[model samples]
Target: MPITEKEVRKIAQLARISIDDKDICSYEDQLNKILAFVDEMKAVETEGIIPLAHPSEETQKLRSDKVSEKNQRESYQSVAPTTENGLYLVPQVIE
Candidate 1:
């Protein structure tokens, strides 16, 4: 069903949008066209069509998972104010 001008005005009011009086007819026409297009799309036949994640049939290129950096945890944590069992200690903020 096509959207009426009164519905368009109500929608603008509900959304708290301030539309010009001349623009209300334009919005009503645009919304009606969109609804008509949706109705047209609903009539298409798709009995056995499969949904697709992507339009193209290409696989992603992945690199091998490997460690590329040396461990620097102890070197970095050495400057912290407090640490116990390799964990930095922070003052409790909540009870």
Candidate 2:
């Protein structure tokens, strides 16, 4: 369907985009072309085709779920300026 100038203005308003008076016709033409392409795509036959998330049939590979690092809280706290009972100390800013 060919888009009208009024419809294009409404679209620009809804999308919060600025459109010049000279560019309105250009935008309307582009939008009409896109609508025509969508209309053409709707006419294509897909009666038995199953919908899929991916284009390829192969599944993605994943690594094994396991813990690779040990907890070193004491070691990390040793490098801090002030630490007590495995916790870092910071100055109070708010009353």
Highest TM-score: which candidate? 2
lDDT of 1 at 77: 94
Candidate 1 lDDT at 47 equals 80
Tell me the deviation in Å of residue 69 in model 1. 29
Q: lDDT tens string, model 2, 1-93?
A: 588999999989999999999999999999998898888777788889987878887778887898878998888888899988887889886
Runs off by more than 4 Å, candidate 1: 44-95
Q: 13-84 in candidate 1: lDDT tens per residue?
A: 999998899998899899898888888877889789987768888788887898888999898899999999
TM-score of 1: 0.42
Assess the local accuracy of residue 26 in candidate 1 as a C-alpha lDDT between 0 and 100.
Answer: 90
Residue pairs with backbone overlap in model 2: none
Query: In model 2, which regions exceed 4 Å deviation?
Result: 45-95
